[model samples]
Target: MLPVLPLFVLTVILSVVSKPVVIRDSQFNLPVVRKLNFTGESTIPELDRARSQSILKRPTRIVHGDAARAVFDVAATNEALQYVTSVGVGTPPTNYTLIVDTGSANTWLGAMKPYVRTNSSVDTGQQVSMTYPSGSFSGEEFTDRLSLGSFNVTVQGLGVASRSIGFENVDGVLGLGPANLTIGTLFPDTEATIPTVTDTGFAQGVLTAHEVSISFQPTTEEVNVNGVVTFGGNNPSRFNNPISFVPLTATSPSKDFIGINQTITYGTSGFPILANAAGIIDAGTTLLLLATDTLQRYLTVVGGSNEPDPETGFYTISPANFARLQSLFFTIGDTAYEFTANAQIWPRSLNTAIGGNPNTIYLITADLGTRSGSGLDFMNGMVWLERFYFIYDVGAGEVGFATTPFTHATTN
Candidate 1:
């Protein structure tokens, strides 16, 4: 059960990411980022700016039924996430579009939307009803086989949400841990058709996360953003010294949305670098979080001088000390998170000169976030945690952090 006060901190930490351990490089050019001083066309707003303006629309619905399973965080080589997707769960089962979450382990979908089904009630928009404070979700399920890497599972559950909490086009979330929400389990015996995780990819093939072999949708029409997340193997063919890992504390097999002040340790030199760091070892979250004090210190370290933003205090970082050969370490309990030559700093984008100032930044995003209308609502963010393999060991009340095969371009 999620204690009341804990999630409040989690909400703050999960909602705000982008500050932690990081390694910046200016080499290995990638197509993901390209604009230095925005020319004319500017699209989506920066994460800091967007999050500061609103509350998250997370649905904590409990649609208990013999349907749905597995939550995978889908993404492309570009690092852009594939929000909505489809998958089938169970034998003679049903399907749902689950939120591909990296934060929690629960995979719940809207078996029912958040509306009074009256005449004017449209089935679109947000249906996520955060009985707590997150928000509501609206989407459905699809029945299909899933695959990733050399592994595949038939008829697994996945969530697809339409209404988003932060970004403009978000479909849903998929909890990516053992002991998932209502329908998913770590063992096939837990339900029918759900195969043993051992059949997919885990040490000894012993069904590491629940009883099902987590699956992914195949890419086709649109960049399915679909891929496999193998356990016990880091595909040495694809990366360098990829680390071997396991969960933190397993007590939180399901959505281990631990306490907010939970420790996040990175690497083996584990010495709790930052104290009571406000963050989450969320598989669903693709970013790290940092307090304002921490954020500023980091920006300065990355050669940031901090300029003004037309939208208030939000600012972006320029390529000043952009090519430092430094590695960042995150401390959560005894775990440490680090990156090897942090990959793409950011893509150069075009903008319509805000407040008449010619854009002069590279890939740095800045802002003194304000949440819940709190005047001093400035916050930490989720940019730093994007390139690490996080372990939210709920069973141990401790979070673990490991490095990823991260590489960056040593050019501006």
Candidate 2:
């Protein structure tokens, strides 16, 4: 004969056996540093242009919902002139330095440092591959522990690279772009879309809001810690003004990325540099790129030498012409954000780092190769981002921007 326990006793036993649900902090902040990885070559323009083109050619995944937040630190690297962050993977965590990109999504490593697997790493046996404007990699997919600052995702999906090309001085990339961009990255699972670090963190209840906020300050030094990435929510202290947001553009090509709608005009003249058009805000690119017609219009208005400098491949002007330069106004939603004259020019002190003469004055605006009406026209890259506080809200399908201390600074 079996004895039956009382209902109260059974409830007590079950309560003692169950694990408690952990509630994480609503937000986290990660500090990032900048490092100069200059190749001492003058090919930056070509490289930036190629990357922009590659980003435009990527497949678009329509996203309809939103999620929560967390934070991770990032730094500027010299080789590709991008923001890099240290990411820990697997059990006991081996730290890998990865480029932080907002133009594509697919977290992978093993370019400069080989990936180390541990008890927490589970190889999915699925082949994964991704191509970028600057590089490409092929590897096997794995689910592992991914840690950033104090937050941890217990079952994060990532790629372990067996072969790679074009990436230098860094392990791989921390893809912070849209989650849907992960489609077609894995073979045999071609229809599956890998959730991004942000997605996985939110799904695992590590973040309370599915949003990321980024802040960057202009600097002349080759290396500096002047940026921070906040996951789950925005760091209100980073911007001086209230953040204004616009829905992600529905236009194709640009719609595939963190796209938005805006118009650019030159100085007080208010002549259009670019009409209302679809474009992306990308951290993967180092310069502010515009359609060919827009670039030519800007050059004509600015009156700088039409020819690109032989060494740096950037439009150069004499100090006299620079003094006459005017601010470029980028009107997004209802606000007119000013792109100061100083912001348009490269930091003179770092000219030699990009193979330019220290005495030469270089402009940051460059040709995107294609003309307007391409659905994707302009790219507000890092150079433009440095002057503003930016936010990408994946779950809500919106992008936010606010003025920062550096927004109108003459740092350059």
- For every model shown, what is its TM-score relative to the native structure? 0.47, 0.89
Q: Model 2, clash count?
A: 18
Residue-level lDDT for 369 in candidate 2: 83
Candidate 1 backbone overlaps, count: 99
> Per-residue lDDT of 1-412 in model 1, one digit per residue for the tens?
0100011101111111222221111112111110111122322234333323322222222111111122222222222322233323344323333334443333434433321222222332222222211333334433333433223454344333434242222223344433222222222233322112222222222222211111222111223232333332222222334343433322211123322343322234443324443333332322233445555555555565565455423345554455552545543444444533332232232222233223454333343343222222222222343354433322223333344443232222
Candidate 1 overall Cα lDDT vs. reference?
A: 0.31
lDDT accuracy of residue 100 in candidate 1: 42
Q: Which RMSD values do the candidates have, in order?
A: 12.4, 11.0
Q: State the lDDT of candidate 2 residue by residue for 40-100, as single tens digits.
A: 3436676677766775545655433333333443333332256777788988999987777
TM-score of 1: 0.47
Output the worst ten-in-a-row residue range by lDDT, candidate 1.
Answer: 1-10
